[model samples]
Target: MSTQTSRLSPEKVWLGITPTLWWNDDFINIDIGIPFEQCISEMALAGYVGCSVGHKYPTDRKTLKAALDLRGLRVSEPWVSTYFTIAAMRKQTIQKVRQQLAFLQEMEGGSEDPRKADLVVAEFGHAVNPLPVALFPNCPNLTDGQWDQLLDGLHDIGRIAKEEGRRLCYHPHLGTGVMAAEAIDRLMENTETSLVHLLLDTGHLAAAGVDPLAVTKRYASRIKHIHLKDIRADVVARIHADGLSFESAIEAGIFTVPGDGSITTFPQILTELAEVGFAGWLVIEAEQAPAKANPLQYAKMARAYLRETLGW
Candidate 1:
């Protein structure tokens, strides 16, 4: 038996890949034509057993499950945006979160498989995608009051998700206000450990010039979900130099599958995860132009690397 299939006791881990590498969910114009079946089929072909929700995915529970069932895949997590800073957005945020939880809780691949966690990134709103990176000069920072609201809102949502038997994990993104090491430290400091958990994405952490290994060591216990996208330092430098838009950075190949990027700390990060008995999906979530980086090829590369490094 392989560690990827069966690991040490008490930790239930699975490998998954997001569909963004095949089709751009945020920027529809990039890979508008990739079929959902082709993307997921390739994922299973690459030896992945789980997948995160993508824009092109079917929403009907039975339909999606039947499709994934045919390919032996299950949903790991789906991206949800919670705009907690704006007071006026509270009602809307809760309503949106409820809808997400309602649907995700019903999502099941097989009767034998365990339930996966729900993921949310504390972001402003949908209309803010492809944000102009140069405007912030660094990155957006939440006001003190907004920080309070954000933490409280996460608790509220976390309570709701718990009631529904799902765990909520927060993702710190590159274009969001929570883009720095200090910012993440502040979030971990202020937010309740149980109510609000972290969804650490190594690509985003490295892109923000923060060491993923250090962050992993600091918050290993709080993490319930993981994203293993690799990033290139030279491309990150170019983004800062050109003040490029978030969309441009992705299209310019700032992110890639693990073992193909400049970041070389995954072995330590995985060790830390194991040390803490971290359990859940370790998803590959690199957003690259499909024309340049074939998603299937990169998927194979990612799986091969993990297999070699983790002996899975």
Candidate 2:
């Protein structure tokens, strides 16, 4: 037998873990509770190649770098989990975008920690559906004008990221303005490759009634970041029946570790990404019940599955 290994680029297969794993009652949880250094150490100890800092984690350069150095982990990406809005209120949207960019700049300047690196990803839009009722009651089905506004905001954000020597990725999440497959397509169509990049989240794509692998293949060229979130179909069904919120569903166990879910097409997804020569950080965003499951343990298992099953 030939001993040739999968020849994907090393950069393409950077495994990352989100600090959301450490969100617990003890950690002061939301974003700031978990000590920055601990976050880096935990991620590194869990076998992740990098760490993606969420909104709650410390964004200061000094703190981030110190943690990275302590844990010997790299900053895979910094996620602006919030900031984009698909509302009709142009002024509010603009304000949010400006504030987001400002935050990014602040973090960059404050990145005194070797591990607190660049803001590599900027997600735009949310998953709030039932248009005209949910978050954007005034604007159901993101109008052309609203889309233009979002695009403008992304353009500005992208400019800042580029100048700061970072990459800007747009995440199309479930229950947000760009929830459906067509909506993602539309947004991608409207966006220029140079202005923004795609953060392919498999779980959100599946939750939104789209084939995650299909969308991944379709937008393979635009994707730069990846969130490997797995979901439980039964819990998802219950959430649908009860009209429960996404956050609630997460609380109720609508998602779990990669190997513990109903998502069975992992090999295919890995194959497709490999075929397309798509290389980027593969982040394990296992949003399971914190009370029942330990995030660090689950994350470690997910990393094992990715390596064994996906050969990543």
Evaluate all candidate structures by whole-model CA lDDT and list the values in order: 0.81, 0.64
Q: What shift in Å separates residue 55 of candidate 2 from its native position after superposition?
A: 5.1
Error of 2 at 305 (Å): 0.6
Worst 10 residues of 2 by lDDT: 130-139
TM-score each candidate: 0.93, 0.79
Model 1 scores worst on lDDT over the 10 consecutive residues at 1-10
Error of 1 at 99 (Å): 0.8
Tens-place lDDT digits, model 2, residues 114-153 = 3333344333444353232322222236667667767777
In candidate 2, residue 252 scores what lDDT? 71
Candidate RMSDs in order: 2.8, 4.9
Model 1: CA > 4 A from native: 1-11, 109-112, 125-129, 133-138
TM-score, cand. 2: 0.79
